[model samples]
Target: RAFARSEVWDLLESCHLRCNPLGDAGVAELARGRQRRFLRHLDIAHSDVTDDGLTELSKSDRFPGLQSLEVGYGYSVRSPNAGPAFGPDGIAALLTTEQWALKRLHVSVVSDTPLAGRFEELRSRFADRLTIQQIGTDPHR
Candidate 1:
């Protein structure tokens, strides 16, 4: 279910590509959209995205109007092996970008990993503007 760059130009402001197999290429294309400035919420969770994909998304001024993001839902009950596709470096790349306006960032971190430590650090850095949360099981409950 990949969207053509031109096709999403108008109503892609709040995209939800979760578990749709949009891989890194799709994510990159979306991030590089001509209408990116109009994008507000982007959810790429449980897809085939990678660290480089996230890096591409973090490129200069890519998502200026983005507010909420949800990127790793591998742990969701739907697919245990689904993701955590992009790692801490990927997340760090986005956080380090300038003029970030994210209000919420939802991700999944394996309980015992260096990524968890990094997430704590990221949470502290964006505490004022971002609310990072680990998506829990029982999403419908």
Candidate 2:
């Protein structure tokens, strides 16, 4: 609920935004930014974002200056709606976007999901600029 307000998006001077349990609605608001030019670090871990949200974030115009993206698990408590926030396809989509300035990505891959198998590929695709880290468990399949 912390990152749901449009006022937060209006603060263009802010460089870092961190929140958990935000779900898709909060992410949608964040991704809907038309003037958030200064946002650099975005941490929305332990939320309910899916591939759609990830796709929006990967857009060339969205978060053009964003340097770090932290998603997936970071909390001890899990939501009933929680699931694989994004997978290899999401990462691949992000990599294809030419306008992103991302340097680091923090993720939590559920140990049992197919995404776990794609970590190496993600690393290879991003080379040394993008760092993806697993932070917790995988909820949905």
TM-score of each: 0.71, 0.68
Candidate 1: where is the Cα deviation over 4 Å? 60-62, 75-83, 99-103, 109-115, 135-141
Highest-TM-score candidate: 1
What's the lDDT for residue 54 in model 1? 75
Q: Kindly list the per-residue Cα lDDT of model 2 for residues 1-141, writing each as its tens digit.
A: 434445556555334344555565666766664555677776765566666776676763656666777766433344444455566776666666776544466665444434466767777877765566653355553
Whole-model Cα lDDT of every candidate shown, in order: 0.67, 0.60
Candidate 1 on 1-141: residue-level lDDT in tens?
245456545656887878787787887777765556777887887777788987887774656778978777355455565546676787777767764544466665432223457767877887765455554455464
Candidate 1: minimum summed lDDT over ten consecutive residues — where?
A: 107-116
